[model samples]
Target: MNADHADDSLLICRTLGGCPDATRARATGLDADGMDFAVAVAGIEVPVRIPFARRISERAEIRQEVVRMYEQACDALGVPPRSAERNSRSRPGLK
Candidate 1:
């Protein structure tokens, strides 16, 4: 994959990794506009697509946009953010 695609993939993975109920969710697609995720619900796997509030023009904005989407999803599901542990553990020198 190209550099931009790889970076976007990582951002998507990190974002979804922070979602508590996304164990069964898989990213299906991504673009400058938004991303698509396949999530399991009610014994069925459905696509959950989230578009950014505005077009993202730079790679630096991907993380923020992804985080925003994650927070929005968590709010909609009435769950707390799940990335705290993951983020801490992924750090270079944190315990």
Candidate 2:
């Protein structure tokens, strides 16, 4: 992901861990291969599968790359981490 998307991406992942408010998603790494991650809630394991890269690019330069990736996963699952969707889709302006 580019620098501009870094913030959104990171926000997405961090928010996904709100289900039990204990476990957090962790990223292993990324490269030409697919994504690698783990779900540990309250220090326990949660079933999860991370999506790998589809294209070639340099690794994330930011320090929060892993968190961003996790948030992306949460978004895919339609669950924003720490999410409330205040001005979300159902909001008047969204439609």
Candidate 3:
């Protein structure tokens, strides 16, 4: 389910602060939902769509599992611990 703007502020900030190669922040205007803010991430308008607690829990579980798997793989392959997180996110279905 979608979230109220207040509950999704941190997420919005993070999304805005992500690796935007070079894009102007334009006040394009309200979307169908009348949101006051929006961004075109990698060419898609991803406004705040915070999931319910259950979904958040499930995502956390998936993240932990992925981190564990990546850590194990890194240890087995003797890669650095600092780099496992990147690999974890790169794994399919983790995002």
TM-scores of the models, in the order given: 0.51, 0.34, 0.26
The window of 10 residues in a row where model 1 has the poorest summed lDDT is: 86-95
Q: How close is candidate 3 to the true structure, as a TM-score?
A: 0.26
Q: What lDDT would each prediction earn against the true structure?
A: 0.54, 0.44, 0.34
Residue-wise lDDT of candidate 3 within 1-59, one digit each (tens)?
12422212223223332423312222233222222334445666644322222322343
The C-alpha stretches of model 1 lying farther than 4 A from their native spots are 1-23, 76-95
- Model 2: per-residue lDDT, tens digit, 1-95? 43343333333334433333423444445555444445455666654433443443556533344455554655566665534665654421111
- Higher-lDDT candidate of 1 and 2: 1
Candidate 3, residue 33: the lDDT equals: 24
Better of 1 and 3 by lDDT: 1
Give per-residue CA lDDT, model 1, range 1-95, as digits (tens): 23333333333333443433333555677789987766554456667666787788998887788768656654554445556446542422111
C-alpha-based local distance difference test score of model 2: 0.44
Better-scoring candidate (lDDT), 2 or 3: 2
Best candidate, lDDT: 1
**Span of 10 residues, lowest total lDDT, candidate 2:** 86-95
